[model samples]
Target: MIEAVKIKTERLILRQWQDADRDPWRAMNADPEVMRYFPAPLTADESDALMTRCRDGIAQHGAGFWALERMQDGQFLGFVGLNCIGHDIAVKGQWEIGWRLARHAWGQGYATEAATASMAHGFGPMALPRIIAYTASTNLASMAVMQRIGMTHAAAEDFDHPLLPEGHPLRRHVVWEKIA
Candidate 1:
């Protein structure tokens, strides 16, 4: 069944989002620090729409960003997985592996662990030859996670995010990738 492919990492359950997840999902996106790299927080309607998009994408594509949760207590922990992104050099039509855990979940290895699983899914089950982790140049925390997950910086091949306006904070992004 489509619902059965929810992937599990060490301490997190990457599962399909339920209708109940909208409130917490909205709250997580509404966090200023969590939405720092993105332009703005999603309004309630926007958040609802986003979850719908994610759901539809997965239903159509078989894999997309899954709703992550704590395995032990079933606590929602935002998301970690692959999403099609604005493409660039060295690898075109790349699936971007990414994560966003709550502030309470930081400093733990959750992001890295969950990301590792997603990366494996990218290279293994998903059978993609490559996956990338792109982040704002100044986002040390995100960069650290990328490094922790064994991705190496591809500085020579990095490109300023085209979707970001010139000089936007997220425009100065560094890319790290893993290729099989």
Candidate 2:
């Protein structure tokens, strides 16, 4: 088993989930604007279940979508880290870097800051050969973050997400990859 780890950046901390993170995480997940790129906002139960899985992944793999915290005030911002894609998507079975920040945390470069740290940890200590990031084709903000972190997009690597049904506006996904 991989040991639990925490990564720090110039302005953020990428660490494990905490008890106090629940409410803020729930609120972020429930925000329509925050979930706009996805299908829908997560309910309280859905948020809790996702947290449980994140925690479990951390316990089993030593890393997951880490709880992002601002270093200045120690406030819970959101999450940015690595996770394994369980489905047969373009990056299936690969470690994928992702991030989600509260609306208040937007436009501040926090996602990019935290994600840079996460990518370093994956490529350095984790010895991962590469990391992939993907999002709905319309999510320019997320795509920008991926680019800022040095991931490259290839049109041939794009694929329709299996979880999103046919005819869904967000079914088509663009994938970005960063090689070690």
Backbone N/Cα/C clashes per model = 0, 0
- Residue 13 lDDT (model 2): 84
Instruction: Judge candidate 1 against the unseen true structure and give its global Cα lDDT, from 0 to 1.
Output: 0.81
- Please write out the lDDT profile of model 2 over residues 34-146, one tens digit for every residue: 99999999999999999888877887889889999999999999899999887676678989999999999999999998898889989988899989998999999999999
Against the true structure, candidate 2 reaches a TM-score of 0.95
Q: Where does candidate 1 clash, by residue pair?
A: none
- Worst 10 contiguous positions by lDDT, candidate 2: 84-93
Candidate 1: worst-modelled 10 consecutive residues by lDDT: 85-94
Per-model C-alpha lDDT, please? 0.81, 0.91
Q: Write the per-residue lDDT of candidate 1 for residues 13-119, one digit (tens) a residue.
A: 98777877888899988999988887788888988988987777677667788888999998888888888763454345678888887888888889888888888
Model 1 ranges off by over 4 Å: 1-4, 86-92
Listed in order, each prediction's TM-score against the native is 0.88, 0.95
